[model samples]
Target: MSGRQEQINLDTLEPQQLAQVKKQLDEELEHLTNSFAQLHAAQNKFKDCLRCVKSRSGAPEDIGTGFLVEKKLKSAEKFYESKVEELGNNLKDLEVIVQRKQTNARTIEEVLRQKILASQGQDQQQA
Candidate 1:
């Protein structure tokens, strides 16, 4: 629950432990949000680079150094393409983790809160 890259950590808790689980869920969701933002920025940058490469390719290269620049751009284009795929995969994984965590925390919190309320009602009735 350090809010790092990894997902939720519910270890070392009692069977019905809830607070720590909630904490881990919150941290995981936040981490996923941050990662998604980073991936989006990378995707936009890759698109910009792609546009530049395409535009340059259409230019009539009637001078030296054009080939070199084109070659460099090709290499960069490949790199960006691979990066886009990688980021997309990462985004998908984080999305799954976040969704799972959200469901689990909500379920557990609802159960625990209801249990607490029921116990309070019993105590008042007995008093």
Candidate 2:
């Protein structure tokens, strides 16, 4: 009854039960074969449809070339837009880093200036 096929002990089954099980298995096999044939026919029909679509020639509008091109252009536009957005974010991050470095450089310059002034004062006093 479940997805798994349970092993039946043929020796334990009565003669009537064994005959009924065999008949049921035969019916199941027939049904499966019929279903497989139907699926194969349907697949062949789809292949025929693909062949027709590929071989038919008409105006670009009639054959959907315009729709396909528009779809492709939209996809490319979205890709480039995303790339531009990513680049913008990267530029903002770089700007922040540059600002931080500039601040650090100014702080170091002020410290050096203070040291120079102190040394000059000490030298003047010694002279």
lDDT of each: 0.71, 0.53
Per-prediction count of colliding residue pairs? 0, 0
Off by more than 4 A, model 1 = 1-16, 58-68
Error of 1 at 14 (Å): 7.8
**Candidate 1 structure, TM-score to reference:** 0.71
lDDT of 1 by residue, 1-127 (tens): 2246554343434435666667766887787788778888888787777777766754344357546655666788888788778877877887777787788878767766776787789999999
Write model 2 residue lDDT over 90-120, tens digit each, in one string. 5455455445445544544455456567668
Error of 1 at 8 (Å): 12
Best-performing candidate as measured by TM-score: 1
Model 1 lDDT at residue 55:
68
